[model samples]
Target chain A: MDTAFCPTCQVIQPTTGNVDYFRLFSLQFSFSLAVEQLEENYQSLQRQFHPDRFASRSATERRLSLEHVTRINQAYQTIRDPLLRSEYLLERLGYRVADPGQSEPQDPAFLMEVMEQREALEAVDLSAAGAAQQLGRMREETERCLEQDEAQLARLFASCLPAEAGREAVCAPELRQQIVRVNHRLRYHRRFLEALDQAEENISEQGV
Target chain B: MAYNERVLDHYENPRNVGSLDKNDPQVGTGMVGAPACGDVMKLQIRVDDQGVISEAKFKTFGCGSAIASSSLVTEWLKGKSLDEALLIKNQQVAEELALPPVKIHCSVLAEDAIKTAVADYRQKQKSMG
Candidate 1:
């Protein structure tokens, strides 16, 4: 309903800027998304707003089609990624994650654990036997942590969003804090994955 | 983003890139992370008998900006009293490096590391006395 289409005039319309990404894709507001369906919707929207389709149309209509396509692409990109989706939903619900340097005091114990794990990773000798397998196992462990973070986020979002349609979404402060915490862990896991990729590259380079 | 010359200098030739023994009574270690950028920094300082920071060391797992921030601070920490070290601000580090708004957080992380390490040292001192 919030797309570039008039009900009766059959002409492209403009967005009101209030339309969230979920509404752009005509989906419900939730962390649990059907990614395959989202991809299908994305393809259909891209086709519908293809610039070539507006070549013979009015200049205004052509511009509107381009704008629609750009917005659609952005919405798809944001909603498709689990971490980005969580952040978007949290922002929409009035929860701003702590800014750098102003963040709540983290648990020193947790920080020490992460530091130790990083140290362990750095110590892995790729030249040693079974180092590749060791790296693979570590990657798996990090991925499992990421999945658990996502699952926790899904449950938190479910509880935070309003149950009834047309009613305002009520964001509980406690739940908001929990979501922020999980989001931090998700970021850490994602970064760890990048580090693992770097290690994998090192192993390959050595093999060559 | 292209880093400024000062940032690049610190990042490329990062000073005191190592770790001090955390168990040492005179050594204070600070480990901090910025989840937004997925950066982790560890900064440590060893106090001499005169209660001045005689040495500083750091190991950072982050971008050039983050590394530069910690590196620059480690250079500053040496020879400063704990009170003087505490006075060092993130804004000063940001200004010194000419960091962009996004990477200003890197300087902030460095500032946090300093404060944390100072606090840790104080805590250890209090417990021992």
Candidate 2:
């Protein structure tokens, strides 16, 4: 039902492969990004590659726009979040939390901490009124831990990534270890936050 | 969102939801978590002299699928010998629950919990002997 896009998006730029998400969105290839600017760029790219602009074109051109639009959305999601972006960068630099695939996370100490938190959450009194009091305090604890993980992420990223060029050059073993630790820590906090949300839902479902 | 009837029944009235004494020599405790979802399950089994599971208990902090999975396992564990219990597999539990593909992990966790609890019991037996 359409055709005639402007010259700006005549072709998808990274057709060859290994498209760095940060660079795809006109941002430096680093852990930190101006999230607002990233969102702005995402919208602009989506507009540029809007499928409606390609319907009247050849079949291949139409299909490419569809594919490119999906890629743009994926890149936008990866680049916009601090946690996901850190994991992405760490993987790009060859840091793997599970080396042989599907193995449990190797850090026993961290999992022990996760276990304790879960235990504490489950032990809370489920009585409606008490649940609120317990969950509120639990929320503060989880939020505080989440914030600390985020601060660690920021610190690691700030140290590992320069303001300009050559992300590969910065992947020293020490930095890789730091990134992996931060990534694991970040996952723990993210998962805890998710659990806290589920707990709150269950409590409120009981009208607590 | 159409859960299997068996799964719903189990979730609504989870069987054997509690703790067993960790200090008891006959009680083997298995605690596990899935980092992907932050689901934690603690399953305990009391083994008699013949290695038959005398009683089973569990406390799970997770979704309905996980709760159903653990409850189903505890029910299966009672009266089964430790050797017989080893034959249990995640696929069987998944099929029994008619769990959707995404919730198959719950079944896997259930299977893992069984093996872990039994292993803990055996280890204690060996230590005391």
Candidate 3:
């Protein structure tokens, strides 16, 4: 079923069908996308589904417009954020990202790295000299890690596209494993960034 | 969401909230992470010459439940032998803390941390012997 209007009636359709977010935005199933283009698409979709336009129409049409708008907002929110977008794409391919504290045995070395980073962040004396500079450096480092993981995700996702234009895509086990690996790294990066933000908040709260 | 009294207690005044030397042959270290909540947990155990867990410590960066889970386990680790510590389960942790359904994973992480720490200790012993 089309995400927007019915083919025969040209009327807004109910959101019962499982519409992939990429299809809703008419986008290819890839991680790397133009944010500006996505913004324009989102704005246009919002205009098309604006519930106010259906105020004079049938009751079904009004309800359908509201549903479509809600779905569009959710889809846009998911695709606009890189971490969420990657997770959504993986979900589309039938991969379930492990929930917090439910992860498999991750690499010990990586966990140690994460532990050290968190420990360093925890030990920072916000009122100490050059604290702001230290926080800035940490934020930049975490952001760099996020960018690297995103770039790797883009490459991996591109490799797993369907062979033909309309064929169903099959995700090989190796690809899924790599995707999961990068997803975990992205999650860690996000956590570290949060820690950095908390440290900065601490400094400001101290009136330093 | 409001944490139960037990979870809050552990979170506010976490027990054994520190680190042990990973290089110490008598110390075993386990590091684990939950990608779902972006929580990392590091659990360490120091074994006595008699093979009993003499001391335990943890450093967790996560939600209240996670911090409490690890903190609670460190307390449990003391006075237990390595083999006995391996018997500890996430379910027990969850039940003790009265963790909400969504926060059960925090207990699972603590369980994994214990197993990993024990494994690390065993590995070091084998290499030394």
- The candidate that achieves the highest TM-score relative to the unseen native structure: 3
TM-score ranking of the models = 3, 1, 2
Q: List the candidate 1 regions with Cα displacement exceeding 4 Å.
A: A98-101, A127-129
In candidate 1, list every pair of residues with a backbone clash: none
- How well is each residue in A145-179 modelled by candidate 2, as lDDT tens digits? 86787777777777766767644636668877766
Q: Interface root mean square deviation of every model, in Å?
A: 2.1, 4.4, 2.2
Ranked by lDDT, the better of candidates 1 and 2 is: 1
TM-score of chain B of 3: 0.99
Backbone atom clashes (below 3 Å) for every candidate: 0, 0, 2
Quick one: best lDDT, which candidate?
A: 3
Candidate 3 Cα deviation (angstroms), residue A75:
0.7
Chain A TM-score, each candidate? 0.89, 0.84, 0.90
TM for every model, in the order presented, reads 0.93, 0.73, 0.95
- For model 3, report DockQ: 0.72
> Higher TM-score: candidate 2 or 3?
3
True contacts kept of each: 0.47, 0.18, 0.88
Which candidate comes out best when scored by DockQ? 3
